[model samples]
Target: MFENLSERLERSFKILKGQGSITELNVAETLKDVRRALLDADVNYNVAKRFTDDVKKKAIGRNVLTAVKPNELMVKIVRDELAELMGGTAAEFKIDGNPAVILMSGLQGSGKTTFSAKLANLLKSKNGKKPMMVACDVYRPAAIEQLKVLANQLGVPVYSEEGSKDPVSIAKHAINEAKNQGCDVVIVDTAGRLAIDEEMMTEIAAIKKAINPTETLFVVDSMTGQDAVNTAKEFNERLDFDGVVLTKLDGDTRGGAALSIRKVVDKPIKFVGTGEKVDALDLFHPDRMADRILGMGDIISLVERAQQQYDEEEAKKLEAKIAKNQFDFNDFLSQIQQVKRMGNLKDLVSMIPGVGKMVKDMDISDDAFKGIEAIIYSMTPEERKHPSLLDGRRRKRLAMGSGTSIQEVNRLITQFDQIRKVMKQLQGGKAAKMAKMASRLRRR
Candidate 1:
């Protein structure tokens, strides 16, 4: 996400690499480079200056222990300072009311509507809450329809009053509807203008007054750089928003808004939009983000995603099948599906330490398993259950059905067989313990 900033920060740490201990002169040199990196990332002049100053002070104050290298100590100091700058810990949304009302505020095209749907989907799936999206963007009927379509896809109800010009009324009515429907959360998607104006502020203020929302989130596009921070300040002045939502973090953002917004508006970033998908919303964590900026992969978030998608009962059943030598094409297909459920493939793979930097330039599509899934889907029920029964003739038939060649099918079968062997070794206990140890290291 902040690949450029990460590269710059890593180079800044190299100033202390050959030094045996940290001195004021060396720390100043390193902090100067770090300051430049933050500026290059579009961080505010004052914020970046204070950040590096704090980092320098921390580095100089630490004892020069024998076990820690000077460079390692400096990196630690920088990481802590960065975390503190971004808000030391994660701040969750207040969804405690009977029908918790979350009002989305931002300029047009800042992804307010999309984020509303994503938040609803997240609460429904993760928090086990029945959320109803309220479409109050009456100026654009298409926007309301978009919210409705997204809500339908998520299997969540959407409340909207067509042809209603009064957004406040629509919001109030939607909240009542949510209460009637037994919804635990109501996400109101309000209308936004191209820029901040009195009218826009007035409309939002009225909606807030009418609803007395439990949470008001100001959504800003991270790609706007310094403008995002400025807009956030303007919004907070009028709305006094509960938290910030930085959208389009998946884009080539220069890390400006993320680094400066919290400092500028004095509000914690509650959520980040990593992608356009409804499942792309992530809770903001300052420490984890600092690790990402320092080119250290966020393995904790990766494992949490895995745990969310990993079905323990299903895994135990698959282990039993592997031990019985009954793991077949169907089981392999199921495993692929489970991995896909963990979110984007490239995002997941990049969380592994060293893997992200190694393959940063490679094209890892979200559908990395398209070919494998197609091949598996082409197989009949009997073929999926009994992969050993497939001969040369059967392989050719399967290849043609899946729009692939015989060699491709053969390669998949070979990989699946190897996976099954690994599963068997894991079930035998020796390999499983080693795998667990490796996972723990990656998480660190």
Candidate 2:
């Protein structure tokens, strides 16, 4: 997401490469590069300057232990400074009140509606809360319908009063409806103007007054860069928002918004919209973001994501099947699907330690499994359940049906067989054999 900034920061760190110790001259050289990188990323000029200064001060003040190298210490200092710049710790959403109300405020086209749906889905799936969305964007004719469609897709209830011009009353009624439905959280999606206007401010203020939301989030487009900070300042001046929601982070945004918003508005970023999908919302974590910006992978978050998507019962059953030599195409497909469910393939892979830098220049498409899935889907049920049933004739037919070559089909079968064998060895606690293979690959 912050690919440009990441590359620049990595280059900045290289200024300390082969250096004997962290010195004032070396730190200045590196901070200059760091400042340029942040400015290029669209970070506010003042914020960027302050950030680099802080990083330099921290880097130079380090004790320079004999165990740690200068470049490593500099990287650590910059990572800490970056984390502080982006809100030192993660903030939790307030869902404490009975039928807690969360009011969403943002300019038009700021992804408020989409984020509302994503938040609902996140709460529903992650927090196990019953969330109901209230569509109060009554000005736009299609806004309410859009939110309704998203709510339906998320399988969440929507409370909206069509043709109602009064957003405050609509919000009030929606909250009451949420209470009636026993919803734990009521998210009121208010209307947004093309720009900041008094009328829009007055209406959102009234809605906030009426509903008395536990959390008032100001959603901004991260692609807006410095303009995002200005928008947040205006919104916070009026609504006094509790947190920020940075949207469209999956895009090639320079990452100016996320870095500047917290420093400008003094509000923690509560959530980030990574993609357009309803399940693409991620809780903002400063440490992981710092790691990402430094070109270091976030293994902790990766493990957490895996744990979230890992089904213990399903894993047990799959292990049993593997032990019995019954791991077929169907099982392989299921495993791939589970990994896909965790997150985008590139993102998930980049979370592995050392893999991010190794594959930073490589193109890993989200649909990396498309060909394999197509081949598997072309197989008959019996063939999927029993790979041995796929003889040469069956392989040719499957290849034709899947629009792939026979060689590709055979390659997949061979890889699947090898994977199953390795998994069986692991299950048998053959760590020495696995370590030998890993060592051999590394040597190669």
Supply every candidate's count of residue pairs whose N, Cα or C atoms clash at under 3 angstroms.
Answer: 0, 0
Best by TM-score: 1
lDDT of 2 at 437: 44
lDDT of 2 by residue, 361-415 (tens): 7888888888899899999999999888888999899899998999999998889
CA-lDDT, candidates in order: 0.88, 0.87
Badly placed stretches (over 4 Å) of model 2 are: 430-444
Candidate 1 yields a Cα-based lDDT of 0.88
Residue pairs in steric clash, candidate 2?
none
TM match of model 1 to true structure: 0.96
Scored by Cα lDDT, where does model 2 land?
0.87
TM-score of each: 0.96, 0.94
Give the distance in Å from residue 269's predicted Cα in candidate 2 to where it truly belongs.
0.5
lDDT of 1 by residue, 1-444 (tens): 888998888898899998988999999999899999999999999999988877876778678899999999888888888899999999977999989999999999999999998999899998999999998888888898899899899999988876779989988988888889999899999898898899999999999999999999999999999999999999899899999999999889998899998888999999999998898989999999988888778999997887676555676576678779898988788778878778877777778877778777889898788989888898889989988878898889989998989999999988888988877777759655644554565455
